[model samples]
Target: MAQNTDGGNPFAEPGELDNPFQDPAVIQHRPSPQYATLDVYNPFETREPPSAYEPPAPAPLPPPSAPSQSSRKLSPTEPKNYGSYSSQASAAAATAELLKKQEELNRKAEELDRRERELQHAALGGKATRQNNWPPLPSFCPVQPCFFQDISMEIPQEFQKTVSTMYYLWMCSTLALLLNFLACLASFCVETNNGTGFGLSILWIILFTPCSFVCWYRPMYKAFRSDSSFNFFVFFFIFFAQDVLFVLQAIGIPGWGFSGWISALVVLRTNTAVAVIMLLVALLFTGIAVLGIVMLKRIHSLYRRTGASFQKAQQEFAAGVFSNPAVRTAAANAATGAAENAFRAP
Candidate 1:
């Protein structure tokens, strides 16, 4: 190149000769090239050193091993296995419940069997062998019980309540009759004219008590027990007569054995205490009449349901009469005598 006009270092790098600040002194004062290194400022390392009393950190765990083919296959079916287990548990519970019901049915069947056996035993003369508990008499008494009455044992489940009601009605009638006797006695004490009533009251009690029991009550009992049409008819006839008697007794006609409403009113003027007693007796009689009517209707309804009729009663009566051993023996003797007489005449 031509001799430079400006004064400049001839041995300098090509671009440094144009820059005056690129001197060695300035370059030395300038920052050195910062090369990136592996070291870095860590915030966790800046924390205080671990205390000597603290437990040491656990070592890093090893990586998990690869799953085997069998385990991998079973993993996908885990939910299905759980579902099958729940279904089996429910099935077991249902089976247990069914077993419990079967046990209950078996227990009921056994109870029924026991009842049937007892009934069969009772039917085969067991009832006759049992001692009579009704008309409960003291052992020292000379008179023994005439009948054995056990509504629960003798009557069917359907007829038990009806029979019990009739029995209670009979007891009430007996008590009323006793009260009537007392009232009549009281009336006689207050007025001499009532002597006839007092006298007749005794006879009525003696006559009506046993007769009513035998004729109407016994027939009703037998009718319900044996389903006998003849007994039912007898009960109806006698009970109707009893109903009429109740009405007559409730009417309280003068000089009648009963201390009825009319008699009570008549005695009211004579003695108030006697009148009160008589009125009570009269009301009892009236109630008996009403109850009798109701009971009659109930019995008739039951009879209708039983399919009993006059023809059935007649048939039963005829059959009963013909079945008598005494009647059969008499008939045989008569026939034999007639045959002998005919042969002798020939």
Candidate 2:
């Protein structure tokens, strides 16, 4: 081998040289990481190496305030979207408020419509059907004459009992009148000619039967039915007169042949049994008279409570008179005739 001056031997096995990096003191005294706390280990202690290896600690970050201060300094230069955000929030609020108001208005409109429908229903007499048809046939059925049906509306539930009692009284009064006629017939059979008395009885039935229903009872029925002060007053006046006549007839006054008193007078001279019967019939007539007075008082009390006055009656009467088709036609004809006469005279 040739002699080399750079080092002793290049190929010889590496020898332990005095290198600074390889010194134990330099290795032991190597700089520790700035972020971690270094712990001293004892050689004598039995220690186990950690199963998982840990990485070296990284360099420490700067103080927290340093980044915050830098961000604060840069904030003024950045663009803000304040105007767009505020406008969007306000528009959303306004749209929500408008929707709420619209819903409220729709609810009010629906309520008004419902009220209008109810009012219209009430105006049509509170009946299920709009058409004022007789017998009130079903909506699906063809129109037919229901003559035997209860075509008229019933009295109000509150007043039905009271009205029914009044109707019963009217029936009693009619029955009493018919009984008087029978008594008259018996008296005539004993005293006068039977044919004449029988004819009179028939005539009385024919005349009074219809009048009983139409003149007095029907008027009173209508009074309670309509609850009209005018009709009530009219019925009271007319029925009071009729009841007075009934009383006179029952007393057997000479002109009052329809009374039980007349029958009793005719039979009292002859038959005691017939006389007793006739007297009872007379008592019935007196009872009817008393009942009429009582009913008149009751009806008057009801009328007074109605807040109706003579002025209202007068107005109603005038309206009824003027509204009459016959009266209106006659008045028109009279006016036309007067105009023609005036033209002819001139």
Which prediction has the highest lDDT against the true structure?
Answer: 1
Model 1, 229-270: lDDT tens per residue? 999999999999999999988888879789999999999998
Q: Report the alpha-carbon TM-score of model 2 versus the true structure.
A: 0.52
Best by TM-score: 1
Cα error of candidate 1 at position 59, Å: 37
lDDT of each model, Cα atoms only?
Answer: 0.84, 0.67
Candidate 2 Cα errors over 4 Å, as ranges: 1-154, 193-202, 259-266
- Model 2: ten consecutive residues of lowest lDDT: 145-154
The alpha-carbon lDDT assigned to residue 80 of candidate 2 equals 49
Measured with C-alpha atoms, the lDDT of residue 24 in candidate 1 is 83
Q: Score candidate 2 by lDDT.
A: 0.67
